[model samples]
Target: MRAVSLVPSLSEAVARTAPGVLVGVTDWCTHPAALDAVRVGGTKNPRVELIASLAPDLVIANEEENRAPDLQALRAAGAEVLVTEVRDVPQAFRELARVLDACGVRARPRWLDEAEETWAALPVPDDRLRAVVPIWRRPWMVLGRDTFAGDVLARLGVTPVHADHPDRYPRVPLEELRECGAELVVLPDEPYRFTADDGPEAFPGLPCALVSGRHLTWYGPSLGEAPRVLGRALRAARR
Candidate 1:
């Protein structure tokens, strides 16, 4: 089966589970750095014409990472598109299995199973910290309601300060974020590339944890080590 993936995490999952199935992938699908698929542009603005030209049996995408019009255009061009919605860890696992199954892999991949086991075995955190988790800087957008990254942090005992906001990713003034009374500030290295020299200074007195965006945001093989990796960073920052 020939498949094209627009989402980075899904692309990596398909590439790892069924090696030769991916015929095209978005430019941001960087995992398995040696992936040999036709470059189909960025996720938010994929080259629909180029993708349809590949004549893939199926195209994979995500609700949040991909735009609706692009998916509609692909379907109009006679391409089959499978859209996934993953708001938390359990949903991520379910969607991963579903996507792989759609790609003709009836048996579950071992990495998927290992990922589940790894998350399940994590010991409960002794303390929970309220954090303001930023995904982008310039305008200062943050993780708000029901995001996969927020859920990932929740499992590790780091809750986002804006998790109850109506918008999933809310744009707030930097001044507001600083005075939000959060116990910690978590910065990721993707969608924005926040680093020690950049994001930490914004919240002067609060502890800031610089985490991997792939492990914190992506919902594929990276799930296996997210708990340990994110946990360690959070612990170190608290120290």
Candidate 2:
């Protein structure tokens, strides 16, 4: 079965679970370090015609990471597309299984099982810290409402300040974010690449936890270690 993955996490999941199945992937699908699939541009602006030319049996994508028009175009070009929606950990696991199954994988991948077990074994936090999670600077877009990253952090005892916002990802002023009464600022290393030197400085006195974006945001194999890695980072930042 020839498959093309537009979402990075799904790409890694498929690559690890069923090697040699993915014929094309987006430029941002960087896991496995040595993935040998054809580059199909970025997720948002994937080369649809180029992808269609590959004549893959199936194309994988996400509701948030990929554009609707692109998926429509793929279908119009006679390509089968499977789109996934993952808002929380449970949904992520379910969707992962669904995508793999669609790719003709009968046996559930060991990593998927490990990730489920790891999350299930995590003890719920007694105290949750309120935080503002910035996915990007400049325009200052933050994690708001229902989001996979926000849910992941919530599991690790960090609650996003804008989780109740009307928009999923809202653009807020830096000053507003600073004054949101959040005790912590959670920054991930992707979509913005927030670092110890770069992002924490903007939050002033608030504790800034620089977490791995892949572990925090991506819902593939990284989910297995997200609890420990994010918990450790949050603990250190609060110290």
Q: Can you give the lDDT of residue 94 in candidate 1?
A: 98
Q: How far is candidate 2 from the true structure (C-alpha RMSD, Å)?
A: 0.7
- Worst 10-residue stretch by lDDT in candidate 2? 222-231
- Least well predicted 10-residue stretch by lDDT in candidate 1: 118-127
Over 65-132, each residue of candidate 1 has an lDDT whose tens digit, in order, gives 99999999999999999999999999999999999999999899889999999988877878899999
For all predictions, the C-alpha RMSD in Å is: 0.8, 0.7
**lDDT, candidate 2, 1-239, per-residue tens:** 99999999999999999999999999999998999999999999999999999989999999999999999999999999999999999999999999999999999988999999999988899999999999999999999999999999888888999999999999999999999999999999998999989888988888888999999899898888888898899999999
Off by over 4 Å in 2: none
Clashing pairs for model 2 are none
